[model samples]
Target: MTLLFLHLSRSDYKNFLNFMTELSYQCNITLHQSDIFSFLKEETYDLAIIDAFNPCSFLVIEKLGIPFIAFCPGLFINAGRVGIPGPLSYVPEYKSSLTDRMDFFGRLKNTLAFMVSSVIVMKMDALFDQVIDEHFPAGSRPTIADLHLKPELWIYNVDFSIEFSRPLLPNVQWIGGLLTKPAKPVTPELEDFIAESGESGFIVVTLGSMISSLPVEEFLKEMNDGFAKMPQKVIWRYDRSDWPEELNVAHNVQLVDWLSQNDLLGRVFVKHAFGVGTGVPNLSLNHKAFTIEQAKHWCYQTWKKVAPQLSYMSGVRDWVDQRK
Candidate 1:
């Protein structure tokens, strides 16, 4: 959590500049060599399973001289690092918000996004120059991008069944929904709340933890009023303690700090989230979009077919043994 550097300049590059600034100041700055790094140099390791989004981990690879697996925890975070063969014509830019079914203008925007994102990534990588120079000899210094490509395998936390179909590299693999648990029945309290709505099913609202609370009181009032009009009971992930004491709670809405997303994924789903894998396509086998049952079938099939073979091919089973 300690910051070693925090420097940023206003630029005409817009979002790319903001991204580079936030990344450098908030994340990478603290990765500078310390006693922990000294301890790392003295220890021998079999393999490094890296959180690819944290480019700082590249320093660990440099120090350890160990084989690695580039593990991307989010579906599209720093997606281009592994070079997964996303053609701009069909594959939308990471954060450009364009769909696979793009018109000419959408294609142009996606292309531009790709170019801007590339420049941003390169600049962000270069920010490690100071640390790299101080830690290693000039002849031995490696480009951050080079270290990224050196990973023996790349694993993304994504389900291809609910994503746009794209060609993938041989080293790349998908293992999303691996952590998903079977849906459990809703508790009696939640059941009673939904039953009060008669035939109208409940609406689940989770604004994500990042920007959960509304700062503007008026905006909160307006939003609260809008939710009040809905006949369906609302199960919102809003901390009750954070609620404004001045405002009245919506009669139809049930405020909660958390809810089981897996337990409630049935009937009809209106998914709203800001992420690459979750959006777009929500697609599956044969390009059929929004067929949950078929998607589940294909996802299960992929798991059954790929899991056994992948362990053998990637040597994950042996690697795990080495770790143990």
Candidate 2:
């Protein structure tokens, strides 16, 4: 079988390749990764996997005359096109953080968000059409709306645990954290530091990639003050060496240029805000401090269900065979 993978971010491209490589050992599969822009008409494939977030690229896959799968790295946003209710009533928008159940205000807000999202999608589809018309002859390709309505499978990189309950199409699948992996080995210095902390242990502070670069002098000052009084050691992942001289870091708090976050999460305690990568399997900090016992049940439950090994391929395999 041949596959066309299109419009993925650099990180996702590497990850997609890893999945395909493993599949190669099990079956004969020809893959094409690049040069898709100019060769959409000339080349062909048994199936295509297009990034759902990149709606413009959807045009090329629609013109390929083959079955395709919509791969969403995070939450799937094409709910309207697929006849699925979204960000409305029970379904929560990623930003809203509401569960399937909602209050009257929550429902109203979700409906508004859903409407706004639909308008944005419509505008994006118009732009996609313009580009398609330039590349292919007029009336040669299907309109974005028509293409979007075609029956297809959608893979969401999220699960129902954190997400609110919602109806999904028969072809839709939830494979959240399928790519999760075990923490890498910790460095000798980090190992020694943790060992020295003894029963007190350590807390990891990271804003992750999305917020780490923002200018938050006041935020840092507040954090400095908070960690100084804490008894447990703190490992702060701040790359900047020249911290403001006014803020005095406590002896217990150590600043590092970087740290293996996944590795650190496995070893120590963390309490973070709801941002970029916070919903993964871990403890959610309630108060200023929490006992390991609070997180123990969650950690154990998550490990049993979502152990580092990848396991989201069965649906793809079944879909491919059915299409063939």
Candidate 3:
């Protein structure tokens, strides 16, 4: 049997490759670099794992006669369908300010509901007959829409072991948090910064890859000022060269052009961290802090969101565990 892994972007492809290597599966696994649907047309596989961020993969896999799994950052079943009027709706507009975006709880709730629903609809559309045979009893028949609307199909969360409390088909499983590889090693100077921070837990601030191009000076200043009052060291990852020198020289801060996030998050003394960037929420902090307690709470919540699957070895490990 062979496993085909379809990835959307270069970074996602790189991350998936790292994950497959660590899984050490002995099957014939091919990494297709281009558009996944185009690649699917040329090959056949026993099973496929697709990144949920890539909706194109869903449309492609639906036509391919193979067992498939879809992975996303958060809930999967309702993802693309819930908030969206239909599958083809345009992407929602988000505010430039992180504070405004995060504070908009209604949007967040709707988006999450949509994601969860999308996952269910996608799986039912893909595995309708198969799931019915194994999960549903002999006398019952389920329609495609019924399968899609059924709340029991969601199988996995980022942490796979925790089963959804509601009724669900056995095939659905939570296997998030399986890709906890350490970030690539940093330069000696970056390593030294962590060392100098000493025993008090430090903070690592990054805005991930997609939104890193946003105005850095203003964002960095807000972060620097916020961390200055806290007792922890702050490690800021900025891509630009024009950072204000005064903040760079602060006793409690270290500013770098870039640093390996996986490596830094794995550090022992980095008790709290905040990230502001694209993709799913991982150590995210909105740019404004009205109070010290709020800042600390944000720091704590950010870690909590990403911390669950840090212990798993692979997506499959978490995936399998969720079945239990």
Candidate 4:
């Protein structure tokens, strides 16, 4: 079966391409990445997975009148749209540190944030509609607001277990860890580092894919100072080869160009995992915070959830059939 994949920007396209390349190898799949409107006109597709971040592509796919599925890498945006509870009380918006159980003021902040985000999305959706109308004839296409609610299924990169309890439609599925695989063998350097650390153990730091270099020098200095004071060593996966002299003074900290994040997470580390903006506390402590141990727990749990959903050939035949 042929699948048509569409992403808006170059960076997103490259990131998705990497995953799709590996996916194509496992399944006998013919993938199309050319112009969506033209390709949709000339070809027959068993499925079309469009990036939800790019509403323009979603509008174009809607014009073709084909049944399509949406893939959102961010937090769930369709919860309120799909008749679920609003983010005002129980639910928290993306980047909002508020947990599921919120007080009166926290709920007020969440409601305001939700309304603002919704307005922004509505404006963007209108812009996407205008772009589609410019390309196609006036009366040929529907507005993005009308078509945004038409997807057969929406696969979010988040888990219901981690999120607040809410009513959800049958079309929504949380395929968060469907892409994760078993960790491969780490390099010799990492092996040596792990061995040298011994009982002390080393902490691994990564700010996900979007962040390459540190944002501020003061922050780096503060981190270096903290690392120097700590007893355990640190292995930071940073993009920069040259670090500040102040940071280099801390011999305990080692910066590498890259590291196997999943491999590192699989191993034992401190219960708390801290990032620039996020602080995760493990379940052993408090469940409200985000911790490396909690992340590891969720990662393994997601794998277990995903494995049973996969067919013998690594295809999501079970999940697809569940739509019926």
Model 3 TM-score (2 dp):
0.44
User: TM-score winner among the candidates?
Assistant: 1
Q: lDDT scores for all predictions?
A: 0.59, 0.54, 0.41, 0.53
TM-scores vs. true structure, each candidate: 0.66, 0.57, 0.44, 0.62
Model 4 lDDT per residue over 189-240, tens place: 8778777776877666555555556656665565556556655567776776
Error of 3 at 113 (Å): 9.3
Shift in Å, residue 92, candidate 4: 5.5
The residue ranges of model 2 lying beyond 4 angstroms of the native Cα positions read 1-50, 57-68, 85-99, 102-113, 124-130, 141-152, 181-184, 209-212, 241-250, 255-258, 266-324
Residue 161 displacement in candidate 4 (angstroms): 2.1
Tell me the lDDT of model 4 at 156.
Answer: 77
> What does candidate 3's lDDT look like per residue over 264-305, in tens digits?
663322212222222333332333211112223333344532
- Could you tell me how far off, in angstroms, the CA of residue 249 lies in candidate 2 after the best superposition? 5.5
Candidate with the greatest lDDT versus the true structure = 1
Evaluated against the true structure, the overall lDDT of model 2 is: 0.54
Q: Give lDDT: candidate 3, residue 138.
A: 72
Give candidate 4's total backbone clashes. 5
- Predicted candidate 3: what Cα RMSD to the true structure? 15.8
Model 1 TM-score is 0.66
Give, for candidate 1, the lowest lDDT window spanning 10 residues.
Answer: 1-10
Error of 1 at 109 (Å): 6.1
